[model samples]
Target chain A: MKNFTQFQWLKYTVTNIPDGFDDMYWKKSGSLKISFIILIMFFFGIIAKDRLYGFQFSADYERTFNIIPYIMKSIILFVAWTVGNWSVCTLLDGEGTIKNIFIYSAYAICPYVIQIYINLIFSYILVRDEYIFMQLIEITGTVWSVILMFSAVKAVHQYTLKKTFTAIILTLIMMLIMFIILILFMLLIQQILIFISEIFTEIIYRLRA
Target chain B: MKKFLIMFLCVIIFAFPLNVNATYNYDYMRNAIPSQAGYNVKNVLYFGMNEPQDIFFSGENFYIADTGNNRILVLDYNLENIIKIYDKFIFPNGKETQLNNPEGIYVSGEKIYIADTGNSRVIISDFNSEIIMEIEKPVSEIYDQNKTFIPEKILVDKSGNIYVISGNITTGCMMFSSDGDFTGFFGANRSGRTAENIRNYFVSDKKKSRRKRNIPTGINNFDISEDFIYTCTENSEKTSDIIKKLNSAGKNIFSDRNLHFGDYQSEYSNSGYKPPKISDIDISENGNINFIDSETGHIFQYDKNCKLLFIMGNISGQSGGFEKPSAIETAGKNIYILDSGKNNITVFSETEFGEKVHNAVDLYNSGYYAETLNLWLEILKYDGNYTYAYNGLAYAFLRNGEYKNSMKYAKLAGDSELYNKAFQEYRRIFLKENSGKILIIIFVISGIILIKKRGEKF
Candidate 1:
């Protein structure tokens, strides 16, 4: 019994694990991610969009039979891209690296991937002008996006439901901060542009005269 | 085997009773459509305009502590004439009616009392809108920090007795009879998790954040119930307001202090902690106390003993839903609630079920205890399970000092966890009475044995 007790003590002594530093960093970054999204969406839309935005994917197929499918494809793509960008941005600020963004974005698009497939079947079954059915599809699509966002963040942060909620709040605050910053920056840039425009207009008039 | 059986029986009895009482029946009040008719301004008066702080209804008119406009706006039942306006207040200024942030209004006979919160004094005005008297307790003159007291709300009884909620660091509510006699004063505001600690045993822990946390939410409005005064205090962040029912002498009279959570933080983010003010509290005719969360446009209800019944509100910003309901009052069958944000009054009427219970309680309390008991019994005839009505019967009996009948009906008040403490008290008394003789016999035998042993040893 004494030898067993000593062995137990020795095992514990040998295993001195470090604190969860990455978890702490992830929380702070997750909070900062909200600010980033708000900035990109609201105030600094011009600059942040330039860095985050990419080429629009669209096609005008000339087949009347394929019109509904084509439109649905674009809508799905839009929601998928939004989910993908938001998740990648959040995780990139946390434990994710530049290369991991691609992996995280694919994971973020998981919901849209599942949703688009389900909606395709519903579209085929329903009449073309089924407004009510289409509305249900739209509402469920939005709900799926929220669930995807939550799950993607949860997967990356490795947190419990409660901690995940806290991270969401942090994200919201970050978004709010980004919004404020964007608004101020936009206002400042607008004023500077106005000043430069006036000076340029005067210079052109003088040269013409 | 015998001991195990006995223990098992005891466990079953205890556990069953506990589980049974945890569930309570919650009945929502009937939803009423907004009335466009403003004909009876005299019937339902509007008190407190511009975030009107507090209000009281007497006879036909309502006296308001119009905090924002710095004056009292009295409206008649006909909703007519925004009627007599009293601006003359003393304390801060020499203006038209020098008043500052007036809160709390109560009417007794021909006298009207106002809690001038900002000026820290109780200003009184007669029926004709004349400043009758002003009561102030000056701070220590030696320190030259002499200042009058700030009062929140006032209460008056049929005897013209006045009760004022006052004081600072050592703040407490006080009372003075109609003849200007200081009846009694009790209460001391102590430091705790925040500023509103009246009893001071609240503990705060960063680790225990999951449990329902109690902090020194600000005390906003208070009303005198039949036996106790109920005060509503908003949480530290104004997220929710807890209604604390205290005796006339200021003793907490409830097991779990009832709270009415408001969306103050969500609405008025600019004010931060200062937002989400609980503007007023009033007891309905059925002995139910209702609280108006001014920020969230919600009204909360509590039974006479301060048990929370329900919280009802529309999340929308429209007026009919009660936008910043600052003052609430009830008359006859209609409940009049004032909306400071919308500058209108929303009235709620009882549903058939509500009318039945309200009529029952009214009939019971008005010297018709037997008829009231029968009415409640009649309700049980249909539902056969009106625990609240049974509890009401228990209160009526207890008030009349009929302890036996009170205990009998109280046991029938159901086994909900909500009434566990009350039922425990009933059970305790029952056990004491049944085992009284046995207890005496055991004590006497023990005494005789001690004497015999002493004599032997000696």
Candidate 2:
């Protein structure tokens, strides 16, 4: 058990979810490296879901293709989810740290990343009439990941099911608050830069006069 | 000295305007691509007509409603000779009056239907210039009491049924029987389902009552085929129902097709985004629907299935372009557009590429898919980005049992429905051809599994 690799531990965590998370919390068996790899995979998975899907199923307009939005969305969403959950858990007397929350959350969404590639493959194989199968596969992956997410949060914070749900609701609210604060911060920086530039322009005009 | 000479040459070149006949059509992705000219300006007939509002071809002659001249000019089939001009007519009361701004004219058989708009009456005259029948404003209860009847366009069917479109009427084209009896309205445009209407649906009854009722835009013009009346509207706010083909029952048959009739993307102007204002519609001899946009002065020609074949003309001070294209009429292989601003009839003769596209479209619509194969292939050689040609080639290949080629063209055409049909056939053929090999593999795997089980039992 001590000599088990990170890959083996990841497999164990996926197979025996509740027991695996329990061990991660008590014995500290989970690796942050594995979580980082999962996060990177999630980023590519989001892109592949848009760009690599079959033509019939793809709704993206190729002429207006931009990769920056996809990159920003994935990074911002993942960071916000991790930080929001950590902040909520800290205020609720939960046991999980920010690092633990990030690792567990990334592990929870591993099924989603794997299923995106599977869905991309199925899109090419199935015709439009057989779209129901693709929809079912996508819904199953999302539902399974959601269940895994709930379990991971419960185990990581060592909270009851009700407390875990409340914490999740508060985390979502915290994310929205953080987004508003980010907008305000950006506007404040813009105003300050404009003011400084105007002062420089005024100084140059005075010297010229 | 050399630079001065070069500059002088540049000024001379700039002084003379280039005759650039730039014709374009939208591809499968709705991107405008410069295409081969489908039509060329054969001639511009200037007969001293002022602001002709409408033009109609009756297979023998061309009738122009010279609105500003207050007369109708009948030109020969070649459009070079003026056959006759009718400006005065004796009324039923023995009163002689000249036409007051005849805005619309339609020639059916030996009869000439004129929408004398300023007089608020439709005059049905014959080839002899005799007033056969005069249809004034109807005095029926269904006709609105407060509204004024200002006939803007008029057409007569084979059964002598007169369809009149009033400029102020939004209900539809006013239909009248042979004896000038008012029938019910025909082909009224459906009210636009806008965001405000949706909100009103959920709002309180008091608030809803306070809001003004939404009315549909009036039909600008219409043309008749065998049993259908093709109408076009000039509603800039709504794009849906811009063009409608109504049967006898006044129901739009194209309601289910979800087709966009004009330019999918709106053009930006100083005011705002300007949507296509489809002012006139005319069906050609071979069932091709031609629409002339008054705003852009562009003529959009589509096949019977609404597949765009060619887009010609523009708002330019050139031979092929028009300043204000009010009417479009097709005779034989040439298209005649009445430009009220230019005060001339710009005739567009079909080019070699246009003839090929029309032949292929006609064959495809007539269910001769196999024959259209060569024509469509040739057309693709001329214009590779033509999506309609790709669609025709896909159907031709499907009829010829070339399922793989059919799928390829269908995908290129961006027709997923056609692609699915071809893919289904290809999949069936693939499975049938490999059934024996698949069966052998399955049997070998099961046999090995059974042998392993027996060995373990022993």
Candidate 3:
């Protein structure tokens, strides 16, 4: 939007996650800040207190979506996305390092974190009568954060907008692959535990006989 | 702008896309409670009933299908005394016979159609306990051998066409002629085309074969309203199209009201438990459709236009509530609910405030909004939080050319569309009455200001 310049993502807010990444502050400042951003992202759930704010939650809002698993999934997704883009950008002769990609990508998610906290406060002031005001703010926050993330990707990779968009699309596919690998790894560990336990039981039974 | 955003959100909720509103109150004013209808009910716990499934009221009497008793009990409406126990009936050959598991009964002025389900026949008997005709399973080549004509619920139209719904049958209600001939199936529930079903149709045949096909649930009960027959089915997964209005040609006529037919999202939290099931449907003399959900035991009362009016009965099994609501039929202004689980009938008579609300709705529906406005206002006096009364008053005022009052109530109701209409009317009246005078005053003031500015410059 022409008014995109109005929003400043930096200055000690959740947007600093994306800001630090976009500015490549994670490399010079530290990767630990990325962890702080991800932690803040997780804190979106705690800010979303159960049934406390009537503006957003329904009567059965508790069961609508699991917040913990959702935040974890988001964290996993961005991690996979960073790895995906870094692996591709290496071959494409892109500019951003893996650290730069990870840090900046986390920064993209920071706006949502900041926006939800603001929304939580707004929910307190507004009654059910003024829910639309709260919802519009949430939607605006989401759209703004998406724009920030897109720009962060574009700036960190030092690529054209077209290349950045394509890279984001490929990163989604890589995230899926990463999810499958994670699930398979868990299953493999489970089978090995089962096999080892069975062998131990059989040996114990034979000796007792 | 704030109102505009809320209006959009309300539109999205009512449109019922993606089941989001199912979880949230999309209707700002549309709370789970429809009305402030506190009833003065008298529970009739009459003895000698074994799992009565259906009840019909005609004249000063009502017929209860005493299913386990293997008989139909005709009782006086006011007296509450059983007039006759129609257990023994003389056959055509002058042989005495008795009904076996008669689940449903529809009483006309002179005739009664009893669905003797276990015997697999619909017995047409007169008030004198004389057997007129017995409609057994049709003997024809077209009839499927495995399909037993076990009529669970029977509805006979004014034109001698009998519609019977059998247990576990999804094709439609079985249509029979007056002579007990199989006409065909009528008002079949249409199976929705889902992405999963479509994909399964194309993918591995074995995988698809392993999955149970989604059969349209059987129509639990049907009540004839005017020229159309309204049927209610108990499909827990789908709230859409659970209730249908079928014409003579067996086509659904009430397609516009596919959404908002029942409760959007069930509040039931018990996993693996069956969702709400609409066991019986009844239409009042004033054309209010009442649906009794057996699972939740909540009586969902909707207007003829399918707008929900009141939700009575609770699952909590209180005095006015029901253990298992089997049937609901309205007698005059009073609603009689048969609870088979409790082995009793709960009769609910509207409170003074409820009667006023009903009168207002009646006047509003008949396009006599001016007459209803006073009644709606009276309803608000009793319960200030009642939103429908506000909505009714708004519409009535709008129609009565009282635009300011209309706009005020519309805002209270959170009805944006009606608010806009009222606002438009207000604007028109204001412009028509004072536009010229206001314009002249503005011009005179501007002229004086311009002259003063010129004087200062000079």
Candidate 4:
């Protein structure tokens, strides 16, 4: 029973973190691939709470949840992080695979998700003056998530602190490039579809004549 | 011979050029067009007046502060003839005194208050011309002895507390007790957040106190509205509050966050030549806070809520125009604007449309929003450009529980606060009807995720 617990239950305990977690996360064998999307959804959903939490958003009525945009934003951010980080990590000779990077990055979003759910409940219960408490919670959650991301990258890639920070900065620049490219690609596809339709219409016009 | 003199005087009075009043209503575009419900000039009360600074109407009589003439001229309501001239003021010490540039006059009950500007005194007298109280420069130790107490305007509250405003004194309106004791200055102007002031953050207190702060945003004019005192400043910089509705503590409770004094855009005209200069403010009987901008000669009328309802007059120097507007006082439905430079008073009477708009605004301001809705709708038909009517419609709709319609009107008027409120109510209605279903879906999704997670682990 102890041996099974050591190998199985040990996957999520805090004792095997920083070094042990990153070593396992760098390999495909340690992949909890499904949790990645779930955590991404949570990461975006937690941020939506910022738009919802205080008088920043309109407060005429009780807030209504809109999940579609939050989900889409999370997915986009996840893709941006994975692609950006992988490219930079490859150049820096970091050991982590793209799959490991994705899983670790998503796992870092865990603190924000838990904080968001707690806040979603508290927002209804708390009055306007008590909003300082809500602000403190939000800031703490964000800071925790950010710190986790920094550590996650360092651990997964087995890189030094200086190398990790350098990679992170480069990742941000890469993210912007990838995002622009994606937009251009979508526009190109749209233009091609429009051209094809115009050609088809021309053919149909000749046939009708 | 006596009969001939009487007839001659009658002829001269009749020959006096009394302008028939012309009124202009602001179209949606805020252009003052010739509209009905306007006063003809009626009569320009120029009798025995020279360089007049202020005018007050009380007890069916016009009290003209004939500053240059150094006397308070009592004229009949029609400005046809003079009642009495209050030039000589008898001191309690049996000494004869006279006004130099008496700029302000207030007749409250049996007591008459005169701001004797040249003499630096406020003479409180009865209708019988018997001097009761004389408020001289406050000899209070706190009083800035260097600054002369040249009272330009005066107000006596119900409790007999005297409020006096002097030029170049930023300490605030000097407040005197009923017994003529200097209580203190009330409602001091706030130091504006200018670049010069921000730079003063690094400055030591001794240095800042030594330097003359840029004119200190002094009060240009003020008026009483119910229990509150409303003041307007003509600060060229748009940093500090140009207007304030202050309470008994001298705190502006009705001030919006960073309260602006007058029309947000074009304080003068579309050309934007002049800033908002409230030469005078008069409260209508219905609590409407109305004031005239001396710069543009424009009378900006606002409801008690500080929402502007109408703007009239101009500095075009034509008919229904003014060279320099000095003071504004409303008697009955007529608004008398004293133009100091032109040396004449222009009277603005309400048109039919103006009366209707006033009625709607009066109703809404006094909290009868539901009743004023139809009146506002009628106003829109005549002047679709009127922003007040749209605001009225938005408020009326919000009050009547028509949240969606209210939101639409607010959006049209570009009123974000009202729109947010209506949207909130609409959201509440939606949530009330579907919160249970929403909860079920959320729970179901979470349950599925939990099951999927357990399945993966096992």
For model 4, how does the per-residue alpha-carbon lDDT over A1-209 read when each residue is reduced to its tens digit? Answer: 23333234224522344554554453333446545655655865656574655332334332345665665577777778888999999989998888878877766666667678777777654545456887788888788778778888888788898998899999999999998999899999999999999999999999999
lDDT of 3 at B318: 55
TM-score for the A-chain in each candidate structure: 0.44, 0.91, 0.74, 0.79
Estimate the overall C-alpha local distance difference test score of candidate 4.
Answer: 0.75
- Candidates 2 and 4 compared by DockQ, better number: 2
lDDT of 2 by residue, A108-170 (tens): 888888888889898777777888998888888788788888888998999998999999999
- Each model's lDDT comes to 0.54, 0.87, 0.73, 0.75
Q: Tens digit of lDDT per residue, candidate 1, span A1-209?
A: 12334223222222211212223224332233432332223222222222221111011112123334443344433334344445534653444443333333333333444444455455433433343764576577557556655655555545566766776676565555655776799999999999999999999999999
* Model 3: how far residue B298 lies from native, Å: 1.9
Better of 1 and 2 by lDDT: 2
- Model 1 chain B, poorest ten-residue lDDT window? B31-40
DockQ computed for model 4 against the true two-chain complex using alpha carbons: 0.04
Q: Residue B409 lDDT in model 3?
A: 89
Which candidate should be chosen as best, given TM-score against the real structure? 2
- Give the root-mean-square deviation of each candidate in angstroms: 24.9, 4.6, 12.3, 13.9
**Looking at candidate 4, what is the lDDT of residue A189?**
100
Q: Candidate 1 DockQ category? A: incorrect
lDDT of 2 by residue, B175-229 (tens): 9998889997999998857688779778999988887888888899999998899
- Report the Cα interface RMSD of each model, rounded to 1 decimal: 30.3, 2.5, 10.2, 10.3
